[model samples]
Target: MATAQAAAGRTFTTDIPARLDRLPWSRWHWSIVIGLGTVWILDGLEVTVVGNIASRLSEPGSGLPISSGQVTGTAAALYVAGACVGALFWGRLTDRHGRKKLFMITLAVYLAATALTAVSFSAWWFFLFRFLTGFGIGGEYAAINSAIDELIPSSYRGRVDLVINGSFWIGAVGGSLLSIVALNTDLLPENVGWRLTFALGVVLGLVILLVRRSVPESPRWLLIRGRDREAEEIVASIEQKIEAEKGEPLPEPAGELVIRQRESTSFAEIAHTVFSAYRRRAVLGFSLFVGQAFLYNAITFGFGTILIKFYDIPAGDTGYYFAVIAAGNFVGPLLLGKLFDTVGRRVMISSTYLLSGVLLFGTAWLFSRGSLSAVTLTACWCVVLFFASAGASSAYLTVSEIFPMETRAMSIAFFYALGTAVGGISGPLVFADLTGSGVVGDTVLAFQIGAGLMCAAGLVAAFLAVKAERRSLEDIATPLSVEKAPTAEAVTE
Candidate 1:
């Protein structure tokens, strides 16, 4: 059965089709995962940079002129805005141009914009640059998710993606650590630290670009787009890697072939495509996207402010808080990745949001009573942050796996755009309001509210996730057999 399954999936390994099961860890596959992973990590880092630098950015004489509140708030707003623009514009582009090309395009935008961020003279320049940086970010969600969904092998898909998705925290932690060093030192003005932080973004992007150059374009995409020759080349590359590893010539590509002449695709068609082939999956995906974006935004944007307000901690503590938070984010997904497959997405993800809510609420209460010692505060907060971040990956994992390929980018974009818009708008405003003297006086009631919403979102996801996980991650994203449809086509494929 295993061999049959392997043989049934076709690759471009030869002029004739070869089974794909025999080619696990093909060089091209690894390259795709690595390239996408690098971009994701950087996106997470760049998005969270404002949170790390909020105190300093908002402080007068910090070498940048702005209210810390304004800086943090505006950055949050811009990040979402940029992401919206990217998700909207790039969704179609990713579909039309193919994932690999779109990935490079976004990376270029990200690389250049992030580098220039170091040199902004005023808030306007900084704001505008941050928005442009968001364009890279916007494109990233579409490109990376699309590439990984198509390229990663079936068996290893869940665990590998879970872990790779977790790496986003690495950049966030890196940003926090670097921010700590720059902000704490009298060696450079506050502005210089932020500059360096963004400079490091340039270097990281270059590393990803270097890694990407060795990667092959998606054969699945090439075949679908009617670039059969390029698909064949990509397949040859995969076969070569398998042969080298196995110390034998690799089998050729095989399976039921349904080669169709490619047709031009348009932005408007994305909506039609998404709804037509995989409406249920599309709805679920959009829900997850919106919920995850809202919670993730709150955490990423509001963390620094919360720390500064609640802890009375100085600017350098941004490092400690962010590091701990990023660590939690990274570690939780890793520990939970296998369990996601085992315990099921419904349980793993739903619990993450629910637990995150409980802990966040608890954290708020502790803050209000002045009961949490510094150690306790950090430790408890890390626990909350961990679940939040991990839950985020779980949400993506579920959504990505469930949705069909026909309009994956479009659906993801909708979720991302709406969630960010809502979360981005609400996170700072709500946090500001909750932190006011009138509302539980330093109690994180606002945090509790956000946490509760996360819990609620989790519940909705959990209920829906059974359908998502009805088939394994490796399963083609086909509509349920009994689902109302006149005809069916591949959604997950």
Candidate 2:
């Protein structure tokens, strides 16, 4: 998302042609974000489905040993590893083979693997399926993001992108809801409840696929590949729609779309494009990836588990607490999600980290004392989740915006994968390591550490990042060229 972004933004005047309504979602551009946003939701769901059902997985006679907790956690790690690898393959593939085709591939891999995971009989089988599913997920960092970045208008990009990005929480809720009902039932064996949790992932994926199918090929990719005819066809459709809305001829396409050094770019060539060219992006992008993975992964994967086990919530009603926790998850991103756009990315990020850390510290105090009312505890926790999601959600879209088109996909694939390898892979282990030997081991202290990390990262990022009013996605991407960048990519929806 970071490396290959363009130095451009789409210009949309209120002069929206009346024909705008006639264009299908796919043709409009922002639809790409919507499409990928849905993918992010489903993939995120697959990643956590097993964790949400860890209680059931740990049940006796479920064919797993008492070590099922670690077993599933390890599987989550491996899934992230697969995503790291998959991103390497798919990011470039999208650039080379075109975003549309590779988008299809990632979607299918995730959708199919999710369904298969639902039926696995052994830990190894489950592990293998998750690992494979991670590959498709890896591509998502680039494919949907790149498609969306290239499609949407810049002014609306941050907010719209963040909102679409909010689907991850929506998926998180979906996973929790399924686990809540299915984990409590015998519609499948207790062992099979986890499977049903994963199998249920297919429904969202299918929806993503259907919506994505309506979205058209990337005009940017088409033009770059020298498929000018197809590119023009898409452009013509866009122009025709714009003209119709105006009841007149559309204004000339203003920005110059250049296809430089037309050779097929190898992985090394693609990588060199960033590390060799832009060091500022290298540091910023890596930070975004690592920070997000470290903080967000811990919160999502550990939140429900810790809420039930360490907090002493009864198992029968664990789902209810988990739901409360998930609601906290949704509540965070839903209301404050747009902070990235209105408040400026740096302010929002810094505020998110600082406030969330304070919330965590407060939570730590509450857990240590063990004297807080239930309502107080839940309210405080939910506040933390709100900032957490708002800040964290911005990371994904922000990462996508920071780099140029040439290295956008590659940079995103590299750092997100790197972050996943570092933070995403390590987060659960860190939680598992907490031991909670202290009074608030799993409950308050653990979350404090997580929130503190976000605060720290945000502080560093804020000081280093461009000020909010001055921030624009295109400005940071593609520094090698002396020529001025056009604008940030357009939003389609």
Q: Pick the candidate with the highest lDDT.
A: 1
Q: Per-prediction TM-score, please?
A: 0.86, 0.84
RMSD of 1: 5.7
Best by TM-score: 1
At residue 297, what lDDT does model 2 achieve? 65
Candidate 1 lDDT over residue span 48-104, tens digit each: 666777777766666667676666676667867888888878977886678878888
lDDT of 2 by residue, 151-197 (tens): 66554556666666666666666666667676666465666666656
- Candidate 2 segments whose C-alpha is farther than 4 A from its true place: 1-34, 61-66, 186-188, 242-254, 257-261, 266-269, 372-375, 435-445, 467-476, 479-493
Model 1, residue pairs in steric clash: 17-253, 17-254, 18-252, 18-253, 18-254, 58-68, 404-491, 404-492, 405-491, 477-492
* Model 1 regions more than 4 Å off: 1-22, 26-29, 248-257, 266-269, 436-443, 466-475, 478-493
